[model samples]
Target: METPIKIDISVIVPSYNGMPLFKTSLDSVLAQEGVIYEVLVGNDSPSDGETKNYLNQIENKDLRVFHNEKNLGLFGNLNNLIKHAKGDIVHLWSQDDIMNPNCLLETVKFHNSHPNIAYAFSRVEVINEHDEVIDKTPLSNNDTMSALTHTLTSLMAGSVPGNIANVSIRKNIFETYGYFDVNLKYSGDFEFWCRITEHLPVGIIQKYLIKLRRHTGQLSRNPKMWIYRIEENDAILETLLNRVPKNKLKYINRGLKWRVYNQYFGLYLNLLRSGDNKEAQAFLRVIKKYSNISGFYFRYVILKILSVIKRDKKFLHWLYYKQAFGNNGK
Candidate 1:
């Protein structure tokens, strides 16, 4: 058999309370074939007994470890890891996910053949807590952000949003963009992706390149359950809108379905949580500013009126029961 081709690739996996999944993550990176790669495991755990054990016995000379005394969140941890990476190609690995043995092997092959392409992403198999493949994320490998936005947003609606595990951006994009924003607890990935994708077509592998294990241990979709997502997402939206030109992002627009859905539901929760009718009315005004008035607005208004009245309001609840949810505990 002939010797496999070798190319230096830096794999950065940022860990936070990932003791149980760290070994599987590390082993997956180590299993790459026909490539020279370094596994840099950055631990952000409160105490590192378990993670430290794995790091100490990582017999591979290519595997190096960094212990972050203070736990930097995802964006901060990723920025820190990038600074320590020294390989020709770099990959951002999730500490809880498993990379396919052919992931780096395939990516390197694509990179070697297509030197002009600065970034490439692969298809990822989303697994449940038990690690069974439940879904897959398709990538838009072309170099335009507008086209990518349309492609990715469709994936989001289809249920599997693109993630860092499926992405392998080129080292040059990082050199130009600098680092991921530390200010955002969420939505930072999209900001970075939007910027890099501005110049290059994304490269993609149609095969399932990684197994994304989702469970209680991960923060996968808890943020969506938040009643204040509209408030939070609105803040990030404004930040991006200010920096990026609207015409530049032609395929995208102000009135997206996610924005509408989140705003409508978030306002409902806000009305219920409001201490008094006055605060609730103020929230309603803000909601109108974000979206156009519709029938849903009238439905919520009636619910608030009933909530505000000081006298018996059993009838109001029943009326809103039919209007708001189409059933009132029937």
Candidate 2:
């Protein structure tokens, strides 16, 4: 008789219409080196028959599939998988993201070495729809407080931690701190990270261990997603305001306001360029409610003046590219 394999890690992939990309994600998980892991896929009521057929054809015994009768949102599906996971270390892998072959081995090793750290994460490489590298996010080696403060500041400044695919948490962290908030549409991972950082130190593995896919179909591209993200960010900021040290609060607040104003102004510009005058006017009203930052208002007026002269989508696209990618043009 063969000896039973002891699972050291459980990768929970919460999938909704995750076909095509989900295969790549699963293959990456299966390819991890020097670690005994199981891949648990929680299917949130995929509407297509092809997706169902694909799930049925998965032949690996280590890969388990759970079907939900109704469509559970992302976090809800994650919660379902967490309950079924048997490993001490649990990783939430997005269906669209690909993991490096050594991702599991390194994260598990880091966790074993630093037993006190609640979770560990590696740096991530951002990829486009074609699996081409677009950007890389390298996390600095900082103590718990410093890292937490920096992350909060960045969030307030309109920058998000690109993808949570590189992170692996102890199963106990969720038991102690609670699961991902289902209420949040886009910022659940951000809020969960903040919550964990409040009580425990997080380990940073500097290697690029995961590829985060960004495409037109992703939630980040949806205009409505931005509204949810901004609202959730405000709530997260308020929570962090009460938790962070008094000395850092002022600086954090300033960054938060700057980021908020910039995001609102960017949205306003996008609406104007798209010729959605009604939505643009409505967004202006929303922007006014956030802050009275003079620079943002000035930029908004200039963009509006330019729009009045001629609605040049090409110019708007170029300006957006410059702001986002700078001279490198990546």
Candidate 3:
């Protein structure tokens, strides 16, 4: 009789013509030890066919490859890959990310020990295009932060579990919470992570698990993608704000507004200086849409005037720092 395979985790990578970079990412996953995991690559119909040709050349018992009929945008591609996953745990890996050898082993161990947590993310080393480590995600004193704290950090500061490579989720969690929203081009993962935190406590592994590569070609860095991100942030904030307890509402709300004001407002100033008037107006609308905090328009007008006058670059830079950070650049 043939034996059934026992797969504990499915490391899914959704790819679209990243070529040699995808090879590096897949190689890292294939090298992981001490875990019964399968690597699934969802080739999102790359025009170049390079990924398909490359996958055909590799022969590994643990690797499975699936090709999409058409290009499903990022989140849609992810949802498609999730459907094909066969493991209890699903690890969404970016096509350009490099995983540490122990990443799968450590995550499986963490899940085995803490059975109640829906998802967990490990710290990641942020790497540049040349594969040099530039920075990393912060370490938490505890294994998991409270859902409220995680939500606040995700909404008001920067995203927690910053990229797909750092996070691993139990397959059932997707069944319970639904898939990533396909409409969100740039921020769907951020929105989905926030949604999960609403009901479950998210775990954190202090170890650096992956090298998240940063390059200009990524959607998040493109100026054109920022508008989509702004649109998604509105919905994300509304859902999180409604979930906060009344006692914490006031402070959380204030912090949220301050974050929106600085984030979009700073972008608005830069757009104006660069003479990208249309985008600058779009960012202005986003700031007005999310924040009702005082001094926004006042500061906007000042920055606009300074930008128009073409004042000293140093003074404008200092003024921006003062306006955006205020009080020791908080």
Candidate 4:
């Protein structure tokens, strides 16, 4: 009699509102060449029949699907999926992202080799809605949590040089550290990684193994939600600041500058979409308040002022994102 294979990792994908991209994600999982794993898909949007049915039609026996009667949003869905996850490690799947075929096999190898590492991540490639490569993110494993803070507002989970799909966390972390906080209207993922990367040991695979798709219909499309997200992140920074050592103020300064920039940047994008600039300056006010007009942030703030003297919107996006994400191209 043949012995049943034991699953090495369980990938839990929390999905909603994605029609075209989900299939590509599933296909990538189905194409894996090595490693025995189970793919658990939490269909957060139960009413999303098109997404549910497409997931149900997959031929792989390693797939499991669950449905929520109503949408639980991103955090709730991930919480529910983790409860049902049986793997040693869990990969939070985003519906719109794509993973390389070797994603699982390679990740598992890293986790085993570096047992002290709580989880592992790889570099990510940014793609258009059409899956065309638009840009590549900095995936260098050079103290990401500290390096990114040198320019951005908060140490982001997504900015951990990888996408969620490229991350495989030991289920024990969730068991001990607790689930992603639901009260964080946004920034929950960033907060989760903040908890992990700060204390726990982590390692990286050093390969571009995932894609982050940028599109118009993404949920953060609601500028109000982004505004709220920014606010929530501000609170997180304050809480973290209280806990970090006074010697780390340099990190805090860098983070503060990034936060203020994004506050205005989000407002800027919303204004462009809505054709309103008068109220948008409210966000700009806070940005300028903390902007390092003479320092590292100088490279960004000066460009925008120069561009405005030159009259350009494209320069605005570049300048704003350079502030929000550390000139790490969006």
On lDDT, the leading prediction is 3
Which residue pairs show backbone clashes in model 2?
none
* Backbone clash numbers for all candidates listed: 5, 0, 0, 0
Tens digits of lDDT, candidate 1, 103-206: 88787776666665546667778888777888866655443224334233322232123578767766766888778877767656665665555445555566
Report the candidate with higher TM-score, 2 versus 3: 3
lDDT of 4 by residue, 1-330 (tens): 998677788888888867777878777776776888888888888778898788777777888888888878788888888888777877777887887888888788877777665566677888887789999866564522342342133342233533466677888888878998887756787778766655555666777777778787776555645546666677666655665555545544544444445445646556757866654655454445445435424545554676678844455444344444443535
Model number with the top TM-score: 3
Where is model 4 poorest over a 10-residue stretch in terms of lDDT? 143-152
Q: Per-prediction TM-score, please? A: 0.70, 0.82, 0.86, 0.77
Q: Cα miss at 233, model 1 (Å)?
A: 4.4
User: How many backbone collisions does model 3 have?
Assistant: 0
Model 2 misplacement above 4 A: 1-5, 139-151, 154-160, 293-295, 299-330
Q: Who is ahead in TM-score, 2 or 4?
A: 2
lDDT of 2 by residue, 20-78 (tens): 88888889987888898999988896676666788898798788998888888998999
Model 2 clash number:
0
lDDT of 4 at 201: 56
Off by over 4 Å in 4: 1-4, 139-162, 220-223, 262-274, 277-330
- Give every collision pair in model 3: none
RMSD in angstroms, all models? Answer: 10.2, 6.9, 5.7, 6.1
Worst 10 residues of 2 by lDDT: 321-330
